[model samples]
Target: MKKKLRIGILFGGRSGEHEVSLLSAASILKAIDKKKYDVVPIGITREGRWVTADDAHALLTGSQPPENPRLAGDPEATPTAAVIKRGEAIIVPPVPAESLQPLELHAAAELSPARPALALDVVFPVLHGTFGEDGTIQGLFELADIAYVGSGVLGSAAGMDKAAMKKLFAAEGLPQTPYLAVLRSVWRGNPKAATKKIETALRYPLFVKPANLGSSVGISKVHDRSELAAAMDLAASFDRKLVIEQGVGGPGAKPRELEVAVLGNDSPEASVVGEIVPGSEFYDYEAKYLSDASVPIIPAKLTAAESKQIRQMAIEAFKACDCSGLARVDFLMEPAKGKTKPRIYLNEINTLPGFTSISMYPKLWQATGLPYKQLIDRLIQLAVERHREKHQTRFTRV
Candidate 1:
């Protein structure tokens, strides 16, 4: 029999999106092709404890942590940065050897484990937000010389920061709503001045967001000066910087939420357009995961030409940000009510979009004829292909 590739599935990270990660990982773990791959479920608890199990899906979906998280050499208590002298963890070779074989160390050093949790052929990080999605974990994968699915450190960090992404989009001649970014220091030292700066740049009904987070953890739509200060404070609570974007899809605006999925490396392809009908005030955390009321319109109701144009724009947006593996580019469509030509505005892109059964990313692909299982296979293949390309690059110049 051919040897199976050992894939590490990481989920339940230290972020507001912990539960969301688990859901994504659960779906991925369920759909992976076991014949071609050996699954390794490594879960990080809310307190940051690392645990391996045959049932990571259950642990993640349920509210409580695992019953037997402590392996023989597993630590008595979990550490934040993960010092695995004695814990349900394994060492991934941070520095590489000339021959390219990674050093695999177990927690007990005597477990005789079939495969050390750390020595993965590739990793699929189903984590979102904070350390998980914002380049920190991606950097770890880079240093450990492990092949990880999704964007690299630069792309992940840039994608996490709305202000940075906007700057890149602007430089690429991409259209974006007017916005302002404020630092925590400035807000704390002179909040009034910070508020004035925001007031000066954009109009009211602005969306104040924590510059580095998603799942709408800290976001608000401020209609007036009275709410602007409070909204900034709320966003500042989640991250050091806060972003305020002009309200684009409200009462007077188009109010359309469109999504496009991009796949592969250098020459990525865009999937047919999808639409989101948020179940709440907007696509907030609860409306995204908990609510069943929200709906997605696959091959969204639009003219053939309009759909083609939106999909094309989505690809440009993905390339503009130098994305890899996969991304979901979201846009807003301002349809003509009577006289004006309809305008399509690119909102933002999610490098690591949710894989919930209801999430638009996977749903769009499934509609494109790739089932969940096949989609997982394709992504794993992409990871290996990308890794091979990187391996061919020489580190030192003669």
Candidate 2:
């Protein structure tokens, strides 16, 4: 009999996409192969507390953990005691170690016991946005020397920031829309000047976004100067840097939104292209998670040549940012007019894309012949492979 690998499923992080992360984690927890791996549920609160135990799953799923009988009837009593009793907060040591240490909180000292450290073979972070996906947690994993899923620090940071991602795409000679990166301070310091600079570089019908956010949390489409100020304010509230991109299509036509999933390390492969028909004006946060009207077309309608070109571009964009393990590369295709072929522009890459059951990342791979379970397995395998490869390099002078 073979020993089962203990995989820690880290979810529910401190980000705007925290709820989305929980949804993704729930799907993974249900779908991951149990026979091959011993799954450990680790939940991080919005306040940044790391917790683990049987109740961790419950907490992530938004269910009430088993409460103490003594405090069940007390209206003023909080569930904090029951949560601490059922779940133990954890501390991941930066130095390479085999297990996670339990954090002893003074409030729950009596309720919680000092237990043996929890051992983990690998960490599958289902976290999204800010602290989790922007390389902060990846940096911690690097310091801890743990094999984790998704891109490394540099890849994650660059991927999260649209400005940096666009620069990388431009350097790789991959086609993308014209855009300007503006700082919140500069925009606020001289609104007229900042607006003038953006107006000069890019035309109206622009997309304004926070450079460091995901799931379209702080995104707005501005049609003219009337809406530009409001969009800038909204974007600036989410991130210090804003990426203002020129819209691809002309007149009333909307560009086709396409996506490709890239998987592996060293040599990566792109999945079949997929298209998103946004329910709203754009694939805003509401359309992505809140609404049920948005529809996804797998193996998007495209000519063989066009599909091949976009797929290759996706791989190129992924490698340009030094991404490993997995990523979902997005693209915008201008509507073809007359006899001319449509032009494809590479959009920003998502290092840690949503992994919910309906997410395009897994769906694209599934359409490309890899099912959800096998995709998860392959990602874990890639993470371990990358970790081993990294260890081969000499860190000290000979």
Mind giving the per-residue lDDT tens digits that candidate 1 earns over 94-188? 23231134223335565546533244688888888887878888876776676778888877888888888888888888777788888988999
lDDT of 2 by residue, 21-103 (tens): 99999999999999999888877776565567655677776974444211111122222322222323343222224223432
- Model 2: per-residue Cα lDDT at residue 323: 96
Q: Please provide TM-scores, in order, for all candidate models, with all chains considered together.
A: 0.88, 0.89
**Residue 338, candidate 2: C-alpha displacement in angstroms:** 1.6
> Model 1 misses residue 248 by how many Å?
1.5
Worst 10 residues of 2 by lDDT: 68-77
Mark the regions of model 2 whose C-alpha exceeds 4 Å error after superposition: 64-115
Which regions of candidate 1 fall more than 4 Å away from where they truly are?
Answer: 54-58, 61-109, 112-118, 249-254
